[model samples]
Target: MQAESVGIVAGMALVLKFGRGDAARCRFAISPLQETMSALLVLKDPGRHGWYLPWLRDVEPVVAGLDLGLLGLAVPSNGHGPDFLWPSPTSPLTRIEDDLAQVRATDPAVVAAELAEQARRLDRHTVPGDLYRALTGDPVAARETLVAQQRTAWRALVEPLWDRMRGLLDADITTRARQLADGGLEGLFADLHRRATWKNDELHLTGFRDGTVDLRGRGLILVPTAFGWPNLGIGPTDNTSATSPALVYPMLGTARLWEPATQSPAIVRLLGSGRASVLTETFIPSTTRSLAQRVDLAPATVSEHLAVLRAAGLVTAKRRGREVLYGQTPLSAALLNLDRF
Candidate 1:
């Protein structure tokens, strides 16, 4: 029997839209578990996860030495495979040890069920039989393998960039929290994904499977990721069971993640080196002090450049409480895009 693809190559993509039942149950969270698992996905198929290709290339040498074991096998390189391996909605604050412990504690029944589901959704010979048995039979050992592999991935792939990644993820969460506070859940989902839409008590997502999820009070957990860009993932397939279904998608500020450490010559030519550096760093909203630290310029100097950029309409400023954050406008995006070509 052939298994269905998870949808990257398949004519159809995995769809995860929502309905009225999900409205009241929706909440936001950040999951270390999902981010770690996603890091593996980015590594496995750089093309599928190509949005992060530049970052992947930068860390390739670092991760080349780690033993990923069954991790890569679990999620096929083509981006289609089992869901049980990385079930969504663990916890906003789940630590590495805690997440690994949860994997170790999976009930045999759940494992069996998930295995059966995987068998139906994956190519028959894609996963080696021994690894499958290890995952489902001696599940305890499999959990240990999962934990060890994740730790290796963390040390190699995640730790080096944890500070920047954490900052981006936290900022996203804070922004979404503010959105929720201002306009409620509907407002929060407004800018979530271009493909995702909330309307008439239903959330519609395009470019993927057409299905409706009945929240039934379990609610939807919104998770933002630094690497889960260019695609949206909805999970815990059987939402009827325990563990809330979460829509894990890319955060808003990913374009800035790949910014070169040094200023771009093309941009430098246009704005001069100092203003160009400020322009590049401001792709993601940043406070004057943060931009100063990132570019190693004084706050006063960064503020002056920001004022000029804002005056020229290349950047815009918004007040978030006590501080004014500067971000790139369409003009800035155009400038960066031009540099890429």
Candidate 2:
């Protein structure tokens, strides 16, 4: 059955009802294409998404050369865009090529309908004349054009920085998995987003169009995205052909994702420059070797600082196989004014 908007509250909420086996079926995924589409919104209004300004500044040249007329029209500042652009990821490691292929393979009829829907949402009866004519005249070609543009966008914006982005995304998934294991679905949803809530087997997301989606045991896909800050996205809302429903939410550690770790003067005064720099970089988990490379310190020196910090209750170390990963403790986050979200 198709999910439909049920009722409207003062603050809109999209409610996804979980069935008997739905809880077990829910899983986390990382999508490069989803990040690409979200990045477009940031590009459209960089002021609104200040977290991405650092990235924007770096890609300004690429942004200036590209033709964003079509993509810009599709993804407005309000963040509602075509569903076909973001197909539900089948696995945790869904690739951009596979997602782009799914988009390219979209039915021409579906493309036409979605374009019309976008136009309607933008308060216009139809799209711009030339684009409308192109859609009505030959949707397959239009689809190809859109996909080609998307590929260009992926190469220019997301590809070069994917490793860093993926590291952040993977860390979030690891945290979510731990939440699921320790406290079950409740723990997972509790921290998913401030706008998301879990109650009575129903997952309600605020700031979304009111809807009731009965999963019917098909389950839900939880996607962690780097560029999906300050908003939650529900997919396959009404009339799209996706196997399962998905929720795209901003991941943790985004506020500092683009910023370089510098020694805070106050921190430095207290812990000395070397330890403070190591502490600053430990906000996100890293190994001693990686931390050394990042802070331009020797591995032994970083390890010594980590030992001191760990002994002082400022850092914690977890052993994963042969490598030991170090991360900040709650005390360290409070000291650094870092958001643990």
Candidate 3:
């Protein structure tokens, strides 16, 4: 069946089945972030966001809101209603978490330290100038400062709550609902990818489509979403949800991503190496140093190459520890997979 049809049907089945209890349990487990994400999600993706939980499997792990694709907490989390769900009537110092009593449905204390720390760092208390100006209906005059502050508070909010085994949420009615709505996470992400920007780090997908899965691996790591499942798994050349372990953690850039991520800088370089100007239909990575290594190349040369690949929409890069790590643009990756199949 078409992914569209499959996703829709599966979603319907999920609501019919787990709509009440399990869904509530799942919501109860996390901080107000889930609610904020769900709210903001409604803005960008009404269908997937509107009381309808988006699902995914064999796909890019996406969190909610404008569907923020981890621009990096050098970059952070976003969404609407955070103030309401994880409300903070006071500023700079206030409890920004939701009532754990509700999510006691999950073992909150099990992940309490992490959760407490996260709550302590929320946007509500540490209102970034950008967030304050933006929320208080201030002018964009201090936009840059606002943006910086926003990033800080945002990262604080995003840095925790990846692990939550809300007892009632697992193997419950809600889980069944998601299952019915989605063959699994793979189906959900596929459908959402089609509806939102499904890029690597550039926000380029603009609601692109998917191809076949030609790879899978144990190196894979999945980040959990508000829905209580890993949003998507980053695996080696070959990885899939069915084979990988479900995961959660502090932040995307944590060393753990490297530990479990099957992401290959080598493959990215090999795939993107191309001097053929008229734009050879396909750029193949056939270089040493793996586009990620910036050892010998002059900083200018590296910049030029990155600019080119980024322009061609072949790869993605984010500055890390004074270095830029590049990877396949989600669209490009999907395209290559389509070719492979």
Candidate 4:
């Protein structure tokens, strides 16, 4: 159905309303900063962020050993946090250090106010009495605490697996870019979420929240994330009031993120080692030469494997410039659970 007004029920959905002026402003991007926040969320409550439970368990030894002291403060157990921590998704992407620097530079007064808001949210819950005592009301101290915790969290969690996560995110962007090119906002939203829709120049997130954000020509940035699965988030991509809008959504192909490099027994039995490796790598696109280099197979051998996979309707190839990029077709994606990667 076409979207006019949507209900974004809490824990169910979030509807993002757009205006005529917002059409030109809609764009897709990848955000490392948002992923960091999501990883912290996973660490804080693996049950709520259950999609990553397996991932957390797989990395438990490392995560369990790390000091998570007071870091959970920045991520409210029940609500949102200060805007400075969620930086805007910039094209060409801003480095995490640069974004953290911005957080460190936050005005002390703003930090104090945000922490107070956070305290109120926590107080409403059945939290430990001593926990509230630990939260400092001093803005300077709170900000410093947050910065130290963030650095610790990144080193402990995100840095180790960032390359794989980034590869999946970049692949998602590539797929979405094709959608945007083929169908503009409509096609992009079609695959974005089961509830997200675009019609009459309005983007609707079909849930229960009753509100509207008029882009007013400010534009919107769509970011795909691996850790924020089963839920989507909408907000300003950065700390600046004037920063462009951004929407961060759960990405596909995350299930295999933590899977070991070894081939799945079932898949290997079905497709053999050479063909199975080719299939797994095709979850994201790669040219023959690139795939050969990555899989350490001869270019001709990789091409032959691609031909067989294409004939089996498990892969598709699209030409870009002088290269032909091969990626998994939907059928193959489902069979291999590539969507979960």
What would the TM-scores of all predictions be? 0.67, 0.75, 0.21, 0.70
Q: Residue by residue across 1-341, what tens digits does model 1's lDDT show? A: 01123443333433444555656667777766667777777776677645587878878777767777566655554433455556555555555667566666777566555555554655658768876666556555655686678777777776665545655775687788889789876797798887677666556655555445566667778888886666677766564766677777788777657665556688888888899988887766777877888888998999999999999999988775566778788988787778568
- Tens-digit lDDT string for candidate 3 (181-244): 6654333333332332222211111111233232222221223234312232111112232332
Residues 159-232, candidate 2, lDDT per residue (tens digit)? Answer: 87775566578689888999999998899999888878999989987766766888887888989888878667
Off by over 4 Å in 2: 1-11, 122-128, 239-242, 263-341
User: How does candidate 3 fare on TM-score?
Assistant: 0.21
- Our model 2 lands, by Cα RMSD against the true structure, at 5.5
User: Which is the winner by lDDT between candidate 2 and candidate 4?
Assistant: 2
On a 0 to 100 scale, what is the lDDT of residue 130 in model 2? Answer: 70
Judge candidate 4 at residue 213 and give its lDDT.
62
Model 2, residue 2: distance off in Å is: 14
Model 3 Cα shift for residue 85 (angstroms): 2.4
Q: Sort by TM-score, best first: what order?
A: 2, 4, 1, 3
Error of 1 at 163 (Å): 1.5
Runs of candidate 4 exceeding 4 Å displacement: 1-21, 48-51, 124-136, 237-240, 261-341
Evaluate model 3: give its lDDT. 0.29
Candidate 3: regions farther than 4 A off = 1-32, 35-227, 230-303, 311-313, 316-341
